[model samples]
Target: MSFIHLDRPDCPEAHRPEAHHPDRKLTARKLITRTGSSPPVHCGHVAMVTRVTKNMSAKAKQSNKSADKNANDRNDVASKESDAEKANPQWKLISHEQINTLLDLTVEQVQFQFEEILGLKNYQTCLKEASLLDYFVSGFWWTREMNYTCQQISFIMALLQFLLDNISEKQMPFVDNLNEFAKMISGTRQSPSPEVDSLFDAEQAMSITDYLKCSLFQNYQLYEFLFSQPREELLLGKKVRLPASLCPYVC
Candidate 1:
């Protein structure tokens, strides 16, 4: 058999290079030589991987920012608690700091100076009034529970204000529906942080209930008897006589 030479006219294609197809632009990257990894990498794949990595990094940064914010908030609360505690030992009972926005007297401080009302004993009129400090101490000890809302704090402050305001009154305001108040207090419990959509997130209700039971509710009848408007001394045991002026309720 005669050998076929590559340069022969009949063997023209054997020595010539392959021609490029018109569709090579579209499929150019689809074909590649095996290099060190024996796998092909395309520009599109590289871009896709870069985008995914960038997204993941951004998410990680957001997560870190949230964590840092929570941490800073916790630290701020701790600082406030420390400052409050230093100002008054009674603040020790508070489990957490509260946001008292309505009235500055609720949590920020007392209206009556401590040195004037709760601090001195020798200057106290009615020797029994000296024990007011003890009353506050015991009450605070009973109700130190804190909450996110201002309900419990405001209620406590209101009660204290009423007590102080009507200390010398013939009759202090009395709850006509003690049972209803009790029911409201005993209504519901909640997590420290319930859903925003909740209608009855009243964890402080029970806290107030326990507090009143421990401090105020137990002395309900005593408060009415000691502070409420008494019948006229001349009409006592005979006929009832109303007070000259009634308590201003709307104010």
Candidate 2:
């Protein structure tokens, strides 16, 4: 790098002897007599010029190598950051339709089930349950006239579960409108406040919902494990496990 800097100011036309004619003549005159008809080349001066050329070439090569290395390092850092962003992102709510493919339960229908069949007290408790799978299993039938696919039923259960965990203060009555519920799940409507927003980050939300959606479409045994036994029996496990699921809501 310094050689290039020096060449810009000191050796503008390095290879051309004519470009440095003034210096060449001074060197030649010093080595050869002023009156000499035939002047021999100054061997010592020639050797010095050759050495300077070689040194400049080497310096240029080293500078280029360092520049290439820096470029590669920058590219590697950019690639790693992109991968990290994909792995974990910010979370947003989604629509119920995105998650459910079965019977379209109106918000009125869901509310009716909550108020009439399950009643207000149990409805509130059910919404606050540890596992939505358990709450749905214990509550009123979602299907009566229309044949409800198990997949649709499971999505409804999972949606309810998400609401229980993330329902904002303003959206408490949002279940009254199916359209609103759809918007809530898809993250279209701005949540009333930060408090009601999804608790999980983008990556975690994606993982949990992906599993719940898969279980909705397929037959799964883990539903029982997720929320099956009676509350008393479920709480009978070891002390370490007892505080894992319901403790957040209870405490």
Q: Please give me the total number of clashing residue pairs in predicted model 1.
A: 5
Q: What is candidate 1's lDDT per residue for 1-251, written digit by digit as tens?
A: 87877656667655444322434343333334313233457889999999999999999999999999999999977875564333222222232243232223432253133324355544244333434544554444334344333434434444554454454452444453355454333332322223323212466555566666756567766545444445322122555455657534323
Cα-based RMSD of candidate 1: 15.8
Cα deviation of 165, candidate 1, in Å: 4.4
Winner by lDDT:
1
lDDT of each residue in 1-251, candidate 2, tens digit only = 35443245366665456444656564456445655655755899889999999999999999999999899989877765454323222123223352243234655555444344323444333432334423443321433232333433343444555444333333333224334434434441233334444323355335445544444323223343433344523442454655567878865
What overall lDDT goes with each candidate model? 0.47, 0.44
Per-prediction tally of clashes:
5, 7
Any runs in candidate 2 off by more than 4 Å, and if so which?
1-41, 90-251
**Residue 248's C-alpha lDDT in candidate 1?**
48
Give the CA lDDT, 0 to 100, for residue 88 in model 1: 22
- Listed in order, each prediction's TM-score against the native is 0.31, 0.26
